[model samples]
Target chain A: MTGRHPLVGALSAVALTFLLGPILLVVGVAFTAGDTIEFPPRGLSLRWFAQALSYGPFLEALRTSLLVAMAGTVLALALGLPVALALGRGGARSRGAIGTLFTLPVVVPELVLGYALFQILMVTFRVSAFGALLAGHTVLLLPYAVRVTGSSLAQADRSLEEAARGLGAGGWATFTRVTLPVIAPGVAAACVLSLVTSFNNVPLSLLLNGPGTTTLPVAMLHHVEFAFDPLVAAVCTLLLVLAVAVMLVTERLAGFTDVFARQEADRWRP
Target chain B: MWRRRTTGLLLAPGLAVLALVFLYPVAVTLVAAPAGVDDGGLADRLGALAADEHIWRAAARTVRVAALVTALCLLLGLPVGFLISRSPPRRRAVLLALAVFPLLLSTVVRTYSWLVILGRTGLLSRALTGLGLTERPTQLLYTETAVVIGLTQLFTPLVIITAYGAFAHVHPDLEAAARGLGASAGSAFRRVALPLALPGVLVGATLVFAGAVTAFTTPLLLGGTRTPTLATLLYDYANVTVDWSSAAAVALVMTVVVLAAGALAARVPAKAAPS
Candidate 1:
């Protein structure tokens, strides 16, 4: 209320438009009656959307994308929950080393990571491309799972876990009954983040996906290479709708983006 | 002992994935750099890459584009973040959500919008032609300018979110105190709030730089073959030319540049400008 300078307010509005405007343009183009992609569409029609859905390849790719994203989120959460618990409760010395190790995947260039995985998994180990794709998404999503859950764990009442221990509850029992319930919201947030990240990932999927394993984004990339049509726009619009749905769910989860902000802040701390 | 074992048990699964999937692959890639040369060493291959004007040109373009995008994001994001931080709690929440929402969309989708807007048959060309600004549609795609615009849009949300966190930590009262002491509104922010928020903003800028340099989708689609960046060049080496050795070398270059920037960001003291 106090620092509301008109100049800053107007400029911020323009900045927000710049951020959101292009996506709006794509959505507009999706409903074109004409064959080509143009603004002010050649009059509106839902034909592109119908065409996009009816296209067998796009549907197949969507199925693969959903399968990989769901599996990747599960794998990341299963692996990352424990890391979160360790970082939350482990010794400070080990926390620093392990935290750095976990953060390395995110800090490094993803293209490089994709290439490295391609060489190691496909070339050296003879792993199936689909398996490699799943592994890559899980690795990429792991940091989200760990960071989000760790934030929740940091806020949960440790005294409850301690009380359970003092009352002759075993470690596993205390974790399952007390700690898990308290941080369930955080775990849910982590799941959403992991799911969205895995679903939208491009570079890793681009490298790891072969003929049978192509995800939606990679499929779209290939589609656009030869043809820039309304169908791609239609598919992209559906993705935009899904993204909005995901954001709504994030809002329901409470402080979902705030968890990311905390992660950024924590990274700078000594 | 029991507690230590429990913690280790909790940590093992994640660490195993990190070691086998993330760390091992990266280490192997870095180690493969020298394998590209038949008789010469990594030093010789790196020197050759350095001397090659084509590689250098792409590298320069990559840095220039990244710097421009980082500056643009900081310019646009700083004011927006400052306003968000100062707004009432309800407004702050809505603004934060709006700012962070773009990140939920895939980078491919975000970059795809640019292709629609900037391609020869796209909206900008048609608009320009309609306005009689040009005799025909202007070729905007596959240019460095297009890459800058696309990358800036892709990254500004992240910068805003990061900058909001930075500004939030600088309480509004601190700026008001300066304003009360006879400073102009501009001076109050410049002298008081800006310094406090610089460190966090720098972190965001660093991330944007690293992302711009490493982003494969934007550069590939927007910049195309005519305007190559290190990212797309790496793609070309592996996919088009099938030159694994050169690709490995380029990948290492990208890795080093990003890590160095990160290290530099880390060294900037948190409270650099003390009142």
Candidate 2:
């Protein structure tokens, strides 16, 4: 906490320069509808935003991205919940190994995952966007749901579940009535995280999201091939604001520590 | 054994789902190695990697960039983390969120943002020209430098978040104790504080290395044709040329290398930070 060294200050300054400076500068330049990526604003206009909005290709890509993200989140939640239950309650001997399997997507690079998925869907299954892109996203999102639900499960008052079972509420009813309520915060956190993750994901989406089904990030990839405008900055800024807003809301509701703690405890919980 | 069908039922479906969706992609990729362009077998892909120098060189470039990116992240993140932890609790949330900001933006967006700033007619170039810093715009956007910049921006948050956790764990009392013995403030911190923080720094560096090495968008866009990281190479194989065999080989190597390095780093003992 104590300020003492100039080396630390210099590094902070340089890091911020690389981090915040470019985005701010790009946002500033977007107002310049100067027919190119001009530095000193020739003039300010909303024409680019309008142009970008009306651009059929870009809008379609955006729609594709939203739809894919929505589908991916649902599938991931459906799949991940059981893993959370198993890992969150499994015997100690196998928990660590299962935890490793559940979290591998977060650590493994997207390029590697995407390439692998491409080979499988194309060569193995002969599946296209639906089988490839949707599955790839579902893969990416499993860990988030597992982490969220597992943490909440670990934090839930175990005695309450035991009490419910003792009263013959039965396992299904108790899970829905008791366990599910306790973990709602974690579930919410996972849902938002999964959606944002699906939205921003590029590498995996690029590989798997094919013809007539390009996601937003992949669309931006295609768009940048032909044009350079503030629209990219505008879209990025919007995504950034949305992400920060989600994290703020989720962290306030569920607590950031709880998210990771749940992940960790679920791993260690016998 | 408590024979609860409900528990078994609850766990079965989710595990099966993850195995089908998440685990299958990685599993299939590994399993893909045995097959060739013609017949699909492990011998064919391994032979391709062994025969091709292009793959080796691209991988080497990826490793170099990854190393530099990880090194830069640790160098930059440690201080920001220390400073944030030092600040009062009221401002911590904002600072932390700022650190995590770039992670949320799609890589393509971040790359385009740089495409504007680092371009010849881009904002930074214009500013440099006006300031009389150079005769003309220097090549930055389509080079290694730009890729590094984008990556450092994109992944350093992992370092900050991890380093902050490490920094937070070293109780202030430990530093106070060292200072009580009349050790200079710098010496006490260097000896007492940094050792404790090394693990977090290590974890952060590993994550950054993995992410940057396998980065696709920045190198794909900002790197131009000149820069060929492993991701770009893999992209060329699967998407551009439809060379599934070679692409699988390259991806498998990347996976082994990253996994080995991470698992090794996590276990290495040199990370001792003394109290």
Candidate 3:
């Protein structure tokens, strides 16, 4: 490998700062004792953090968001894992077409998706807000689950399954004992990534929300619209920490770059 | 026969989900765009709406903002991507993880952070005042510049990651050979590496532009009421006014523009494209 150039090193530092500075500032400002959002706080305190906890709408929205995200991730896994397995194992020509179809959700604009889903559910089907939100999040997250698990399945050693079968194991038994264990890390990564994607989603949540069913991000949007205070920063700080923790767990399980690298390969493969 | 059945069964649930949630709705939206019109046909009404000056202004602004964001991402991401690709494996992983960590957070949270930093009494304004760049707090929020800054920060990492993926495949010896053949380092990169990386740059640019054009939170929060983009206009028509037809028109225009850009981007040839 070549030695790092000084210019590139400097640019990296600047880029990191540019990317991470505002986020850090939000976390820092959450500790402010003052009423307004001041960068260098008058005095550090946990007042806003306490306020964000007790806030009724914020907490309710948080609950709704969590539940929806959990439901969506579970459904995506149920559907995506099987599809990934099929695509990985089958030597069919339709694999590419099916994969592209599943990936269309990621490529389409979120706003358009939201608008379309909102009309279909609200105007046509008359589905409940919670159900619509769950469906929307599932659609949004399915691609991630499929891609991650598909890569994992692609890389799994097939000989292990054959060996298990040779040892008199049935298909279900071999899959449970052999294939699932090998791809467990990838499945875990997919779950974590999809959960984060579902939780942090805004556009889909915005259109699908009904009375008393607003998600956290949509609630935050409304809160910011009316108020500008440290409480908002406090809420954002908590979520940011949660996101970072999820990412760290994903890294520990599957290695972060492996996820992206696999995604890149999947996208560019002929 | 059993394997075929199992594979088909496995794909059934996902296909059903897409059919019900994605394909059906999109089709309904496109087909229903002209519905409920009385006096004029759907086409004429859509054309009239398109001719409105406000719609044109928002469309132009959306394109301008998206273009600027794409350009900024490319300028900042290329070098970082190149550096990351060249780095050792361990260091590269750490760097990439750091770069992508922000993307995992909710865009609402990220945009809110920008609000704090760009507000009149926010960090950027305070810094400018402290440094005597301005005698008083500057109005940075609710401007196009603030929107661009926020978006660029949000998207630059994506560009870097995409570019890095492309650059990773490019044989380093190609550049080495060019340099050995009397080309300067800069020219060698421009001649060999840049062309090889064009596909990625185009992909990244398309993603950035689409994100920007379809963006609702950043423009609404950062650009304020004064700066309305197509997303905001669509929201206004669909939600605020409860006018579905007009909203559909706006959405259709936005979709067309984004798809056109993507199509054009895909048409650009990369040196590494397989014959």
lDDT leader = 1
Question: Please, what are the lDDT tens digits per residue for candidate 3 over residues A138-236?
Answer: 998888888888888888899999899999999789889899999999998888878777887888888876875698999999999988788889998
Between candidates 2 and 3, name the one with more favorable lDDT. Answer: 3
Residue B171, candidate 1: alpha-carbon lDDT: 85
**Chain A (alone) TM-scores for all candidate structures:** 0.94, 0.86, 0.93
True contacts kept of each: 0.64, 0.51, 0.53
Is 1 or 3 the stronger prediction by DockQ?
1
Per-residue error for B53 in candidate 3, Å, reads 3.0
lDDT of 2: 0.73
Write down the TM-score of every candidate.
0.95, 0.92, 0.93
Winning candidate number (TM-score): 1
For each candidate in turn, give its C-alpha RMSD to the true structure in angstroms.
Answer: 2.3, 3.0, 2.7
Q: How much is B95 displaced in model 3, in angstroms?
A: 1.4
iRMS, all models: 2.5, 3.5, 2.7
- Compute the lDDT of residue B103 as modeled in candidate 1: 81
Model 1 residue A60 lDDT score: 93
Tens-digit lDDT track for model 1 on A43-134? Answer: 99999999999999989999999999999999999999989888897764568767777777788888888888887777778889998888
Cα lDDT computed for each candidate against the true fold: 0.83, 0.73, 0.81
